[model samples]
Target: MTQQGGTWPDDSETVPLDSGSAPASFVPKSTARRAQSTRPMPQRVGAGAQSYPDTSQFPAQPVSASAQGGAYSNGAQYRQYQQNRQYPQYQQYPQNPQYQQNQQYSNGWQYQQYPQYQQVPAAAPAVAAAPKRTHTRKSPKHGFLALLMWLATAGIVCIMAIREIPFGIDGSRWVPLIAGFVPWLAIASALFLLLSLLWHRRLLAVVSLVCLIFQVVWHIGFFVPTTSLSDEAKQAVTQTDANGLPISTDKYARIMTFNTTTGKADVNAIINEVREQHVEVLCLQEMTEGFVQRLEAAGIDNVLPYHIVAELHHGDNGGCNGIWSLSPMQNVSGDLVEVDASRVAAATITLGDSQVRFVSVHPSSPTRGNQGIWGEGLSSLSSLKEYDHTYVLMGDFNATWDHANFRNILGSRFVDSSQQSGGGFHMTYPANSKIPPLIEIDHIVHDKGVVVGDMQTVELAGSDHRALLATLEAQ
Candidate 1:
C-alpha cells in the first residue's frame, strides 16, 4: 500500500494537500491549462499519481471564482450535478440572466454546464412568431342597433316635416290631420336620440340629434298654455262686480251645450240637472218633434221658460237645435244663420241690464264623408260674432283643436271655452257606448269678453253623445 507522501516502489507521485492541483493523471495537462487560462485557480490538494483513474472519488480540482470563466472541482461538480439533476448541463451555452440564477449551487460554487461532446447545430436563426396583430372592431349588434334608430328618426321626420305638404287626393288630407300630433312624434325622437348615444352608436347619435333639434325648434310648445286669454282678460277673470263680490260664472249664469244624440236623452234627468245645477241657458242639438215632446213632458220648460228652436233640418241628425233660457229671450231668433243639413238657434237674455246672446250650433257630422258640410256649419256659425250683444256660441261643433280646418276657419275671432277656462282636454261625445269618448268633438266657442270660468262634461243615458256645460261671466 502507498503511504502518505511516499513514492511508490515504481517511483510514483504522492498527494500534497497545500499545492493547488487536480489529480495529474486523471485530468489531462490540457484541462489543467484550460482551467488556469480562464481564471485564477482556487486552492486544492492534488491526488497521488495512480495507474488508473479512481472510480469512486473524483480528482480534486481548483475552485474558480466566476462561473462564466471556470467550473467547480470535479467532486464538488458531481455534488452540484446530483443536486441539480432536474436540469440539463448546458445551462451557460446560451448565456443569459435566467441561466445564472438557475445554475447557482447552494454551496456557493457556480459553474457553466456546457456538454463536452455535443455540438450545437448552426441552422438558420429562429424567427420569433410575429406578434399577433390586434385590432378593435365594432360589433355587428352595434351596427344593427344604429340602423334601427336611424329608421325611427326617418319615420318621425317624415311625419312632422312632410305632413303638411299638400297631397293631390282628398283622402290624403288625413295625413295632415294625423300629423297634427307631430309634437308627440318629435318628443319620441328626442328619447331615441338619448338611447342611441347611450349605446355608443356614433352615426345614429348624430343623425337623431340633428332631427331632434329641428323638430324641437319647429314644435317648441310642448305643454299646454295655462291660459289662452290675453294678459288683460286673464286679469279681468279676477275682477269683482259692483257689489264687491267675486264676479264669477256661478254668481248668476251657467250655460250648457249638448248633442243629445237625436234626443235619445233622459229628459227627466236633463230637467232635474238643469234645475239643480242652476243652468240658466241650454243649447241642445239633434232635437226632433218627439224629443221636444219628451223634453216638455219632463218639464224642461219649467226650468227654462224661454227658448228659440231651429227646425231647419228637423228629422235629420244635423237637425233641431234650440237655445233655452231661464229668463225670457228678448231677441229670440232661430233664423240667426242657416247652413244646408244644419241647424242654428240664437236668443238674447237680459242679465242685470246686460243682454247676452246665446247660439245653438250643430255642425254636420264630419264622419260619413260630410266633412265639407261640417265645415260649412262652422262657417255659418261665424256670423254670430256680428251680434250687438256679447256672443256665446255653444253646442256640438263636432271639432276639436286638433282639427286644423276648424281652428283656421274660426281664426282669432273665437276662444275655445275648455282651453281658455282651464278645462284642459276633456273628452265629450260618444257617451253611453262601450268605449266612452276618447275625443272632444263638442266644444263652446265664444267672443273675447265672454269668460269661461268652468267647463264640464255630463254623461246622460240613452244618448251616445255626452253634454258640455260651460259656466260663463262677462269680463
Candidate 2:
C-alpha cells in the first residue's frame, strides 16, 4: 500500500495490483531529468520542486543547482528564472492579438509610401521646366525692341522722300524761303520724337517723326543750280561799248567766301566752276598761307593777285580776308578804321570815258561783343569826302540789310545793284547747307549809276555762299 507523503499517479488513481498486494508506488520518469536541471534531493515534495541535502563527503556543500537556486544562486534570481521560463508558454494567446495589430500597421505604412512616390511623379518635372521657358521668353525682348527701332527708322526715311519731289522746280520762289527752316525743324522734331519714345508715348513719337521727315523732304529740290543765262543770251542782253567792243555787261559781281574749317577746303566743284567761268573777281575769308599758296599754284592767283590777309590769331593761319579783282589798283593804303584788318583802298578804273572808283572793304563780324562792323564800316566810309566820286563799295560786310549799318548804306544814296537790276530777295550766306536763305549780307553798293540789267547768283563752285553779279551803266 502507498504510505503517507508518497506521490499519486500523475494520470489518476494508482494502477490495480493483486487485491492483497501492497499498492505500487507512483514515480515520475522525468524526475531524474528534472533533478539534473534543478538538483533535487530526497526530501523535496510538490510539482517540479527540488531540495538539496547536506552531504558529509565534501568539506563544504557542493555548489549544487538547488543551493544556487537552480543556476541563478539567489532567491530573487530563482524567481527571475521562473519568470523567464513562464514567458514563452504564456505568450501563445498574446500572439493572436499582436497579429491583427501588425496587419493594421503594415497597411498604414504601405498607404503612406504610395503617396510619397506619387508626389515625385509629374509635379517634379513640371516645376523644373517652368523657369527654363521663362528664361527663353526674356531672351527675345531685345530682338523685339530692335525690330521696333528699325520700323521707326524706315518710316522716317519714307517721309523724307515724299517731301523732296515738289520743291525741285528751278524758279520756285519758295525754294530759298523754305530751305532755311528745314534744319531747325528737323532737329526740333527729332528731339521731340526721342523724348516721346522714352516716355512710352507712341502717338507723340509717330507725329514728331512724321513732321521731321516732311521738313527734310520739302527742301530736297530747292538746291537745283540757279538758272544761268546762256552765253548767247548774255550777249543779246548787253549794249556795246563806244569802241564797238563787247562791254563788260555781266549782271552780277560773283564772289565766293569760305571759312575753310581749318586749312582743308575740299571744294572740287568750286575750283572747277571758277575755271569754267573765268570769274573776273574773287573774295575769300579765312585764307591760310597754305590755302593762298595752293590757290596761287592752281592759277587762281591771277584773279586775286592783291590779297589783304587777316591772321585771326595774329599768326595761326586763321581769319584771312582777301580780294581778287580783274582791274589794276593804285594808291593802295589800308588804314585801321576800327581794327587793323578793317580798311579800305581806292582805285581808279576807266570804264570807257567815265572814271569809276572801286573800294574793297571788310569789317569785323558781330562776334564777341563787337556789335557794329556794318555800321562802323559804312559810317566811316560815307563820312569820307573822297567817296563822293562814282564808287563801288564791295566786300563781306558780315551784316545784312536788316542791320542799321547796312540800312544806312541802303537808305543813303547808295543803290543795291541786285534790287535795281534784278528782282526779289537775294539771300546769301551759309553756302553749303540746304537751309532757306535769310538776309542779304553781301552787297555791291554804287552811287549815281544807271542799273543796266538783271542781277544774278553765280554757280557755287567753292565756298559756302554763291557769288552775286550785276551790271551798272555810268551816264
For model 1, the local distance difference test gives 0.62
Task: Compose the digit string of candidate 2's lDDT tens values, residues 1-475.
Answer: 3333675335334333221333333323332223223343355479966544422221221123232222222233334444444433322334555433433431222223333332333323444345443322333664565456556555545434422433123112333233323344566568767866765657767877877767655433223222233454344334444543233444333333334433456445445554444444445555566776777777654434454444344622234555555545454444423333344444545454556666555555555434433335556655543454676666556554333344455555676555454254466666656764555656676774533334556535345555555444444
- Residue 42's lDDT within candidate 1 is 45
lDDT winner among the candidates?
1
Error of 1 at 284 (Å): 0.9
lDDT of model 1 at residue 24? Answer: 34
Report backbone clashes per prediction: 0, 20
Q: In model 1, how large is the Cα lDDT of residue 230?
A: 45
lDDT, residue 95, candidate 2:
51
Q: Estimate each model's TM-score.
A: 0.62, 0.42
TM-score of decoy 2: 0.42
lDDT for each residue of candidate 1 in 88-141, tens digit (9 for 90 to 100): 444435565654554453332333343331354445888999998885576888
